[model samples]
Target: MGSPSSLKLGVQICGVGYGWGEWRHPDVPADASISLNFYRQQAQLAEAGRLDFLFIADSLHIHEKSNPHYLNRFEPLTLLSALATVTEHIGLVATASVSYTEPFNLARQLASLDHLSGGRAGWNVVTSWLSGTADNFGKAEHPPHRVRYYMAREHLSVVKGLWDSWEDDAFVRDKPSGEFFLPSKLHRLDHNGEFFRVKGPLNIARSPQGQPVIFQGGTSVEGREFAAGHADVVFLNPESLTEAQWRYQDIKGRAACLGRNLQQVQVLANIRPVVGRTASEVEQRYQHICQFITLEDALVTLGRPFNDHDFSRYPLDEPFPDVGDLGREHLQGHSEHIKQVARDEKLTLRQTAWRFALPQREFTGTPEQLADRLEHWFQQGAADGFVINPWPGGLQHFVELVIPELQRRGLFRREYSGHTLRDHLQLSTPINRYAPRRELI
Candidate 1:
């Protein structure tokens, strides 16, 4: 808040990249989806550009009609662990679900990553909204929206409690006195909640940043409230500057209402950049990517929010099917967005499918022009930063071209100011919950 110069940037290292047809692109490696080196290279590029974090989004289940990248990819935490060794400063953020994992184990795993990476770790907390995910986890039905948020709130509380199990100075390792750890410093989290009852201290000690940064990405009413109360960052996918501004104000206002400092919670919108040396080139590249998307693939992407309800059975020229209560319980926000788009544009089923196929162009111009748009968003208070998902062959261009333009404009940092992810993002190190109680006045 002190200056207008501060800006946070992150690149989503989406497996095989973001576009649905990216894997088939000539410039993209055919095996990029499973290649560790591909991710390693991407991480290095982001670091070279002085980006804050490399985000890896995940899901527990995949349909046969899923995108090539989703059909095959590394698990988030495991992959981030491997990435930690190769990279030094870039924050490694992985999408993990409270719905699918227990609090204690996840807390330990994230703490370990923070230690291994020297505190450059972030956890994108999700409720796991994909349809059929519950089936794989031995549950016949997915929890309702409100119930999922309830579990998430309780789940985060338990994890945070477990993280504070051991005080920062608990480990003595004093060989001369034959002392290893102070006994009184360890605290057990006997958390009893409606969803879970985790009783224990986390096995791992607190890491350098105290705890990994918490990120949440849901726009529903419950989601907004939960994020305001708990998350350090809120990820968004707003469709326009007006929407982004509205959402930005809403989130910060909610946080303030809950007695949280407005600066503590950052809002990062998803931005898919399509940079080019010329406007004509950008159009060509956009069209080229669009050509690779098959109607079948488009249908699969369009149907995702509706719980993979197959759109193939209906005639392509006809209006979208009524989808009566198809995704009412799951992906309600996204399904509603899609329905609104279809209704507003009066798009046919095929047109809606095609629209879904094309990547949303958050920025598409020369590097300088792209920089202008980003600056506009930042200065206008539409966003604190952006989580960029570059299309195939776009990463190198963005790093080499757009990044420098931004640096020239003094919109991004030329060098990392600190080691931890929190430092890079300008977020404060959280206070340890187990600290000694102060005497009352």
Candidate 2:
């Protein structure tokens, strides 16, 4: 919303990388996923690039066949908190699920992060999609897709209400008067809802930003509605520009219909760009990254969206097996998207497996070419910005190559102009709901 000429970018700081084969790349360390130093370095690198934020993705459940990076990775909030001290200005965004966490705990932890990071904190709200996650959380069954949304709405409502427990000037330490805080400035949430019943004030005071930014990344019908009604930012994973454009328009329209400010909401697409100086180098890098993924690994990876449906049992060359409603209960949108892709392309089971496993080539090209694609997306209103999910060594390439091109074209900022995440995004601080209209302390 600051300017149509520039873009906001965030780096996905996953150590082993987004692709299943990425850790096998020579530039990546096998244990980088768990290494604090590795994360520190990535955070510093992203900050140096003047990126908008650092996104740390998390999942509550993992099986033996899970992606190597997911199998061994730091928790999002813990990792981001560690990152906060080493880097300044770069927003720290952590993904946490509403289905498995208590509202008070989640609210307190995220508020703490906002305070620790000097207001550069964001929470990417997620409804846990894996059916197996229920086992970890001690639930008899995972909440249905619709039920998860209902719980998410209530959970988020309670969290926000708690976040507003104290006014900005609530704490006033006066020695002579022996006053620690203004009593009238402190308020209680006293929330009782369908999913959460939290009472009284939050333990922490209002953070520098007043409230930490809210991020929503669900793509289903319910997910989009949640984002439109509540999210400050929306994360998307569209397979093509056409899909991205449709989602972009749909989300903006939905928010508009709800009478929300269009500029207050931002849409970010997740792009894994395979970059190089030359076409030959780009192809080589792409192939090099692909070599590590075996057919078995692809099958296992494919099974994930289908609620761990065993794709191995079906013939590789045969048409994708019809497992109706297989993924509807879990990852409904994603599983459906995969099935649609398979149907549209008439791909074999093996083809569908590899298609999703390997990084999409829509963003594969030289620096200039990648810049062209990104600029197109921005100018055409397909996205407000992008969450750059790098392959092994890809972040460095993007930072060094594509970013420079964007800056030169006046499509990105060459330097930081502000400190807080809201400032970086040119968004105004939200007034506390509990604060009086014209009262000043």
Candidate 3:
């Protein structure tokens, strides 16, 4: 078994937090979603706990029925840039869609972030899932799953090429010589692919960590392949321990098959913990949060991946509606997952909706108990780490209660040991593409 110190942890600074009913909680501040101070505090707290990174999830477009955080929130890169000044050790990860954004612009922004944050920036690569997103982007319809994934591969290739535009010692800035940069070190990326044609070097110089770390989230065949080839960390939402273990093996195996070191790619699963000091307290807190979800809220929550297909039109008692091919084009992975759950559970429309509103899987119990479960998962090869979606008041509980327990058990770090995000994750600094390759005589 690997040492506990090997685990990589991250916290989701998801606007207003993760729970659907979080905003309705009286204890939670009303303006948390829009408040920079809220995010600042969260980032600082995560850093104090020695968490690896703070993840910010984003979407291109939102519907009226969208979640509170999704409806209104700061753009991820912009917000993370502000956070960069306030945080030092913890990594800053933000999601951006390859479908909607241009390669050059995003590459420049992320490289700048990596430079600004001293190499603590990570980009979560995503092909936008929402159907309505196309309308906003001046498209009649969303690209099909295969096409989107194809574009994503080409997009990432271009971005990576641009990131390697300059070598490590490219900018010498020799005062006496009056040479601002070494001309020989500069490299041009003349990328001409099916999806995009990007020519020449990037505007920014090489980042401190070589380039920003790449994070990806998806479970489809193409998604897994993409992650295996490019992603440093793969965010997952496994339903069970067995499933998590299987996925961990599958992804690692795929990467290994592709001639990548298995250790290079870390699989981090998303978990929402409803923790407390005692069983009674945990139950009380869980019930309190669950009470905030109304039927309307549940319907809206379930309808999101289905392209906002209104479930309210159907009778609650009836079996789940056949939303055949409704959002298959837009949100293929998510829509399929939802349908699989409904089929497996034999759930009605109301049941499925409520399931989304009130998630069933939660790490509930004392700090010790939660720590035990986490250690079990780590030892069992279920996960490399967790992308924790802290429940209402859960952030405080995690840092103060859970973190101490994990550290005491030798499962988590008490203080950061390295500066760069890559260093923290035990990943080696990437070699510059323009660096001359040594050949054996």
TM-score of each: 0.96, 0.97, 0.96
- Per-residue CA lDDT of model 2 for 367-433, tens digit only, reads 9999999999988889999999988888899999999999898889888888899988877798888
Which of the numbered candidates is closest to the native, going by highest lDDT?
2
Q: Which tens-of-lDDT digit does each residue in 1-441 have in candidate 3? A: 224356788999876655566787776787888899989999999999899999998898876667788878899999999999999999999999999999999999999999999999999999987767889999988888789999999999899889988888889898999999988888889888898999969999988898889999888778888898889999888878888899898889999999998778999988888788898987888888788888888887787777778889999988899878887766666778889989999999998888777845447778888888888888899999998887767888888888988888888777787889998887778888668542221
**How high is the CA lDDT of each candidate model?**
0.86, 0.89, 0.85
Candidate closest to the true structure, highest TM-score: 2
Per-residue lDDT of candidate 1, residues 1-441 (tens digit): 113366788988776655567787888888887889988999999999989899999888887677778889888889999999999999999898999899999999999999999999999999988758999999888888889999999999998999899888899999999999998889999998899999998899999999899999887788888888899989988888998999999899999999998777999988887888999988888788778778887888888878778899999998877777776667777788788888889988999998777766767888988899889998898999998887887778899989999888778888887899988877788777768452121
Using TM-score as the measure, name the better of candidate 1 and candidate 2: 2
